[model samples]
Target: MAKYVLTGTYCPDVLEKRAPYREAHLGRLAGLKAAGKVITIGPTRDLTRVFGVYETDSEAEARELIESDPYWQHQIWTSYELFEWIQAF
Candidate 1:
């Protein structure tokens, strides 16, 4: 499986407003983990940037999976970019 990075910018206001939804978002991430689609997930040190690693055949698939996340559906995301990544290490 190829690895892809799903990067997105969060809506700070929405994030502050929906602090309670973090757990549900984690639950959805866990579902992806259980299904072997995601490798890991976390945010940048500044906390404004979010990114996740997906193990799949293509970037489009990764984008589709991320879009289905509750966080995305609930307007927690303000901007997003999908990339097909290559890891040399």
Candidate 2:
């Protein structure tokens, strides 16, 4: 597996917009976490962006995971970029 970094931009008024879907979103992530697919994930201090680390066999798998997220499906997350990461430590 390779490490991937995912940085996502939130839609405007994200705090209010994400409410209904938050529970489902977090629940899904929790499942991925338990499965060892997600390393760590959270929003930035300003909540303008969501950042996460994932371990997957390929970038396609990572992209699929992100695209399947409730946040993405609902537009709570407007856009995202995923990159393969080489952890130095």
Candidate 3:
């Protein structure tokens, strides 16, 4: 598996807008975490962005995971970039 990093921007007024889908989004991430697909995920303290680490066979899989999330489906996440990480440490 390879490590991938995801950095995403939240939609405007995300704090209020995300309320409806937050639970489903978090539940999905929790399931992925337990399955070892997600390493870590969270939003910035200012709530403007989201960052996450994922372990997957390919970038496509990582992207699929993100796109499938309720947050993305519902527009809580406005946009994102994914990178294949070397994880030097």
Candidate 4:
């Protein structure tokens, strides 16, 4: 599997919607973590951006996972981007 970086800007108004979906979102991550898919995940310091590092076989699959996330499904994100990371570390 390859590494990927998922990044996005949250909708300012997503706070209200986020509260309701946070649990479900975390639940999904917990499952991925247990399955050893996610490396790390969290929102930025200012909370404007959210990021996640994942191990996937393809960028297409990673993008699909992110697109299917509750936050994206519920329009909680304002803008987003995903990249296949070529890590030297």
Candidate 4 accuracy as lDDT: 0.84
> To one decimal, what is the Cα RMSD in angstroms of model 3 from the true structure?
0.6
Model 1, 3-51: lDDT tens digits are: 9887888777755855877889888889889998999987777778788
Residue 27, candidate 2: C-alpha displacement in angstroms: 0.4
Ranked by TM-score, top first: 3, 2, 4, 1
On lDDT, the leading prediction is 2
For residues 1-89, write the lDDT of model 3, one tens digit per residue. Answer: 99999999999999899999989988989999999999999999999999999999999999999999999999999999999999989
Tens digits of lDDT, candidate 2, 1-89 = 99999998999999999999999999999999999999999999999999999999999999999999999999999999999999999
**Model 4 lDDT tens row, 10-65:** 98866676988889888998988888778898888878888889898898878887
Measured with C-alpha atoms, the lDDT of residue 78 in candidate 2 is 97
Model 1: residue 63 alpha-carbon error in angstroms: 1.1
TM-score of each: 0.83, 0.97, 0.97, 0.90
- Checking candidate 3 for backbone clashes, the offending pairs are none
Query: Which window of ten consecutive residues has the lowest lDDT sum in model 3?
Result: 21-30
lDDT of each: 0.82, 0.96, 0.96, 0.84
Better of 2 and 4 by lDDT: 2
TM-score of 1: 0.83
